[model samples]
Target: MTEPSSTPHATAPGASASSQTAASQSAADETPASQADFRASARRTFAIEEAAIAALESHLDDDFDRACQLMLATKGRVIVTGMGKSGHVASKIAATLASTGTPAFFVHPGEASHGDLGMITPADVVLALSNSGETAEVTALLPLLKRMGTPLVSMTGKPGSTLARDAEAHLDTSVAQEACPLNLAPTASTTAALVMGDALAVALLEARGFTAEEFALSHPGGSLGRRLLLRVQDVMHHGDALPRVALGSPLRDALLEITRQGMGFTCVIDDDDHLVGVYTDGDLRRTLDQHGDLRALKVDDVMTRGGKTVRASMLAAEAVRIMEENRISVLVVCDEDEHPIGAIHMHGLLASGVI
Candidate 1:
């Protein structure tokens, strides 16, 4: 028997299977038109998926709240399981949840029957995905899951399906149709499942009061964590590496400090080791414009007094903001008494992946 056209846009209602096949073949032969068709198909598919997601907005009801609460209250991780395309979606959802402060991991249904089921614990929650809701492998484990006292949340199109009926909570991810021309491939359904997974992850994230710092902790190896949690003191040059000059020091001597530190600037301090002012490359340029005798001028004479500085506790990102706002490339990190302890350059943020 010939299959029904998955799309409503087919040329004619009465078109024979052979005729449809010929048209598809002919269309495929025209390279430019084939590309256009593929683009149009993908665009339509995205629209359908977007619509599927939008449809979920109203469905974010008491069930969603309960799901978030369940996940948050659980002591163990979330175990996501599915078959076929849903397994792919589950893997991504698990990764998203893991990175966003929700402890989660994907468990394939096929693998579960082969002994991976040992991973499930009573403290964990199972998030099962199957469009038909009747996936054999997934359903076969339902009894074991129940025996373990693990709560199940199912995402499926058929609300009456066995998986849905057995689940403690069911999330409807049914799509009206698929983006595939044949309506057989998993397209819109998978999109809906993925979006719902994201929604759940985010809701749980907020309910748990998960902060960016918590998220950063989970992703410490990436640039994101560096930007969000790294401190200026963590990357700033400290100790003897810092270039310092006394207030009475000659400009030529201060220049030697800048050169030895290779920081393009030097801090001018008082006899008490308290920072009095800063002398930078900009100061050197301006001083040169004045045609002053550098050998005779004191460090304080051309220094920029009360320059912008940051605390050691300040985030590196905040330091970047300060630098950008002041139009400067460096900052002197100071103590409570206004004594320079360390220095950081703008490029340091870049090198450390904070920018």
Candidate 2:
């Protein structure tokens, strides 16, 4: 009180400088991590998961063969079941198995207990997944499946767990550690199960002699299916759309036919209506370079003999291969007698989605 100062209750300018510095440091710390840091984290996960898959090679045993034989002998579909993260992987495995000649589908363990168990039968085989081999939801189905007399194949981390002990075949998928920094989340474990599922699918596919055509039958709505199943006859122009000119006809007639059909070429046929040659854009270029007159040329003189051809039964993908290999844009679909029955051009192949 004796010395009331000029700046009473006011802070000295430098007294709280440490606090200002701390605020600045906090703002800088709030900035998001750099991409490099994130990438390093992801790379570590990849390495961990890769090592988990590699470890699977050494763990292979006779149980793998037993599992395959049980599924192969099943008279009904393979019912795949799991819980939580394992359930998601089981769904994909079922899809892969079904697409690769093994009849299979996914049934959630929880749902299976709630009347979905009816989907399973004694003739079917069950493949179950549980990283701990002690998931209550999945384990609960054990007795019911056994009562149904259905064989069980299990993939689990614990070899001595109840599920593993009850299974006809048990695949050990334990990893030394998880990709998770905390080692609590499902990371490497899921990858191991997925890889093991893929192994089973491919093995069954090879054992069953599954062919591409049969695989295409299951996947008939996409470009993959079109490439394998779409045929030349499905995409080629035939009947009244055929562009043809008899051999020895005026070259202008072939040109007009090519222009009318819009396929860039016209078939040159003989009196027997058998394809003898073709007049194409390439032939047109040669003719223009060889002769100046427009009306005096015969179709036979300008036509390329024995033009590239495909059968109506040939796959559109095979047609694409032939076109790419020969550097041609069109192919005549012919009968056994070499009669031009249809025409397929690059545009048609593109439109069919088989190219």
Candidate 3:
């Protein structure tokens, strides 16, 4: 009939529009279900990895101690080496160890076979990582490491693997299941390895008695470094910026000094220029309440004696602690002889990032 219409009847203008609209509605309906599947998948992955890390706690044993002792006693750095995803985890472990007072650095196993092996010395302890323990690049280095007399520490999912057997210490980072739905990805295994690395770093850190100051020295560019290294003298107001008034100076003069220096307080000094007392905004209010005239009072009459003071050489963080303990905002910096040298306000510590 009519040579059979070239276009299918469903492709007619009105039918085509309706069909496209139906397709759009169908896609819109599937979107929420797709999003729900994605979220459920993420939750399952997190749960599996969390369990993997928790399970590692029971695996910590004598080998873990030996690993730490070997690293601690090494005359040289800890050379961390791994391949593939394990290599990424190894690199991070090296960084964490280095920052926490353990000297360490990462070397790729593939590169090690290509002359990077020279980076490892007999004095250094080699920490090798391979989830499979049979990673060709990593297992290839075992004989070389042994020949060099380098002590080897291996982290692997299989305790009986070649890398583990050859290592002086083996850390089992095996997980019960892979977080990947296909059971092919390194998700849970890598998490276990990372947590084990952190455990080693922290154990070594404690054994070495690594103080916050020591940690800060390794991280001089971070906030902890600023808090540990910044001295009171570095942020204190010195010379003319110091608010000081003589012991017998009028209360009015002391208030003027405080306002002039904008330090909220003024140091009342003796004739010898040693700090004798402190007159603050708190003193002014108290004086107004107890006295008839502010001008008639002397700074010594309202000054608080034996006010808290810090040495100029003290850490700004320590100064913050003192201010916090006393519930005050300002502190006068003094010399060894208790002579007022400078003054610090809470704002100074805040600006210096010491608080």
Candidate 4:
């Protein structure tokens, strides 16, 4: 028998390669469109959330004022409570309120029912958060809170919800819709609640006349606290560490004192030990340019008279402000009688983290 003729399936070598090339081309064509769709979705989400937050400005009405007033007048702590995502936001709000001089703390709604309710007292004000206003754990405490005579402030998306109706003051955090594409996840709604909480905290802060110094006291471990709370006396070199020279002391001797103390300047004092002037490296340069003999000049002659001085009780921040405004680095810390008791340099302030 003759050999069978070869079929096209066995004869065509490029057919399999062509099929694979077509498949890869199809996948490559779909990828860019998929990426574009993701970008469009992200933009839409952001726009929706932005509009949601902007709409909140119109909701700031008398209810907001009443909420602020209640918090401001509360003698005891503001008890913040929520469930799920709302609970996380509640904890942050409580921290902001407490740090800004309004006494507040978070108590989980579920925990509240299990004996943590004892944390609530008649004097304390309850700030409850719920997006739906129907959270079972949160709503369960409303009756008990009311029975205890505790003032209830509710933040909810539904104005008609049970929590809102029972609250002494209700803040409407209702959003048009969530940023979630499914409209199920909490996004815009949570952002709105956070912003509203910030508004309340700031309003109360201003109403109470809370100062930066008070804020620093609450945040003692932070850099802001060091800048606001550190005093000149706290960072200044005192006694033997302070570079000092008597009046009519040689300019060279003053320079030696500056070098020995490593403060870049020396305090020139009169016979009574009161600060008369300051001799600094800048003065030394000027003296060197004006005269030929460093031994012939006196510290008082070349020293800048009546140098900028600060009291020991003055805030380090204020001293730094004065230093920047005057364009000088060294500050003579003086007592009530204008006697130089301490010396502070920019380096000292920077080293102590008060700058």
TM-score of each: 0.88, 0.89, 0.84, 0.85
Q: Which regions in candidate 3 have their CA more than 4 angstroms from the true location?
A: 1-26, 32-39, 285-298
**Per-residue alpha-carbon lDDT of candidate 3 for residues 114-173, written as tens digits (9 for 90 to 100):** 989889999999999999899999999988988899999999999999999998899999
In candidate 4, what residue range of length 10 has the lowest lDDT sum?
Answer: 4-13
lDDT of 2 by residue, 1-355 (tens): 4888857346655557768889888877877763248888999999999999999998789999999999999999999999999999999999999999999999999999999999999999999999999999999999999999999999999899989999999998989899999999999999999999999999999999999989999999878989999999999999989999999898889999989988889999999999999999988998999899969999988799998899999999999999999999999999999999999988889987887
Best by lDDT: 2
Worst 10 residues of 1 by lDDT: 6-15
Write model 4 residue lDDT over 1-355, tens digit each, in one string.
9987788767576788888899998898888675577878889998998998898898888889999888888889999999999999999999999999999999999988999999999999999999999999999998899799999999999999999999989999999999997999999999999999999999999999999989999999899999888999999999899999999988879989989988889999999999999999898888889998888888878999989999999999899999999999999999999999998899989898886
Indicate which candidate wins on TM-score.
2
- Which ranges of candidate 2 are over 4 A from the true structure? 1-32
Number of colliding residue pairs in each model: 0, 0, 0, 0
Q: Write the per-residue lDDT of candidate 1 for residues 191-253, one digit (tens) a residue.
A: 889999999988888877899889889888988888888999999999998889889888999
True-vs-predicted CA distance for residue 285, candidate 4, Å? 1.9
Candidate with the larger lDDT of 2 and 4? 2
Q: Rank order by lDDT, top first? A: 2, 4, 3, 1
- Full candidate order by TM-score, most accurate first: 2, 1, 4, 3
